[model samples]
Target: MALIILAHPNFDKSFANKTIIEALENSKLDLEIRNIHDLYPDFKINAKAEQEALLRHQTIVFQYPFYWYSMPAILKQWFDIVFEYQFAYGSKGDKLKNKNFVPSFTVGSSESSYTALGFQHFRVYEFCKHLEQTAYHTQMNYIDPIYFHGTSLAAGYTPDSIMTNAKHHAQKLIATLSQLQ
Candidate 1:
């Protein structure tokens, strides 16, 4: 099973994230949704409960929007609090070992804009290097990320295009989970 930890500050107003969430909701796979903003509007996180949730799943998916080239404030806080030294690292931190860490996100800019010659000046992988390193430190497998670019202020995109990507997003995630060794 994969646990999707979604953190979107303005979830209600999101078109791309919402579409993907709906697709996941309608899928048949074993999934657990944790909308952090809805769960802890005050930024209060229950570490123990979150740890227990991680222990139950073999895969952990952090789904969110790209905020200032990184994750939202609440999600970053979740990482700081939930992935404790004794639990996610250090000599005794083996609880997360062998698990998979997958990051699913939506980027506002075009995919090409993330290249070296483009505005972002780096690839998506470079942007998410911290996440990959976190997974490595925790002894977990860092799976390929799932991201949909040109999702925000999509000047040239239509509603149908978004929906199509949403449907494909869900399918790809399920496929990735199934292919995991």
Candidate 2:
């Protein structure tokens, strides 16, 4: 199975991510989509359960709607609590050593604005560095992220079109997962 850690706090309001996740959860992708906020409303993650969830899958995806240049707080806690030192980074932390970690995110703006000359003044990668580093520390293979950059700015962001793109992304991910397998 592929562990999909979904961290969209405003999932209900997201026209894009919601469609994406819904397709992922209901499809034949061998996925487990965990809504961080719904699982731990008080910011309390069950370490044992979280670790087990990680161990159960070969590929892990940190799926979220980008917020203020970072992920949601619940995802931060998910990392802190689930990715323990001894199990994920320490000398004995070989559980995730060869696993594949993918960070899938959606942005509210267009792709052009993420360039150095754009209004954001930084590349899309600058915001994703922390996640890359985190995966490296755990010895996981960090794949290039799956991004829907202009969803919010896209025309209407209708369910049909968003779902279409999401299905394509998921299919691409499935191919990537096959390579890892």
Candidate 3:
């Protein structure tokens, strides 16, 4: 099964991420979804519960909107606290070994912005290298992420276009999970 840890601070304000999550729920996939922001409103992460959740699933997904070219503050906090020395790393931290890590995120900027000559000056995967390294250090398989770009300035996308993209996102996610199994 896949465990998706949604970390959007302002989930209601997101059009792309909201639609993508809805599509995932409608799909018949063996997965659990946890909106961390809703669960930990006070920014206090339940480390024991979170670590237990990670242990129950083979594929772990961090789904959220790209904020300032990185994950949301809440998710960062979760990583800082959840991935502790004795649990996720260090000598006895083999809990996450052989697990899969998939990061599904939405980028507000257009795809062109993530280029050598573009404003961001790097590809999406380049920005996500930290995540890959984390997976490696923890002995997990870091699958390439599913990305949805241009949400902030998606002027050309109609309602039908948006829904179509969301459906595609869900399909891709399901396929990714199945392959991992």
Instruction: Report lDDT (CA) for all predictions.
Output: 0.87, 0.81, 0.87
- The digit string of per-residue lDDT tens for model 3 on 1-181 reads 8899999888887677788888878778888999999999999999999999999999998999888878999999999989999899999998999999999988877788889899899888888988999999999998998987766645465555655675687688878888887
Q: Rank the candidates by TM-score, best first.
A: 1, 3, 2
Across 1-181, the per-residue lDDT of candidate 2 in tens digits comes to: 7888888887887777777777676666677878888898898899888888889999998888787888888888889898997899898988898889998887777778888889888978888899889989999998988776666645345566666776776666667765665
The parts of candidate 1 lying over 4 Å away from their true place are: 154-156
Q: What's the CA RMSD for each of the models?
A: 1.5, 2.2, 1.6
Model 3: per-residue Cα lDDT at residue 72? 96
Worst 10 residues of 3 by lDDT: 153-162
TM-score of every prediction relative to native: 0.94, 0.88, 0.94
**Residue 59, model 1: Cα distance from true site in angstroms:** 0.8
lDDT tens digits by residue: candidate 1, 1-181 = 7898999999988777888888878877788999989889999999998999999999988989888899999999999999999999999999999999999888887889999999989988888889889999999999988887777655576667766776777678778877762
Clashes of each: 0, 0, 0
Cand. 1 TM to true fold? 0.94
**lDDT score of residue 180 within candidate 3:** 88
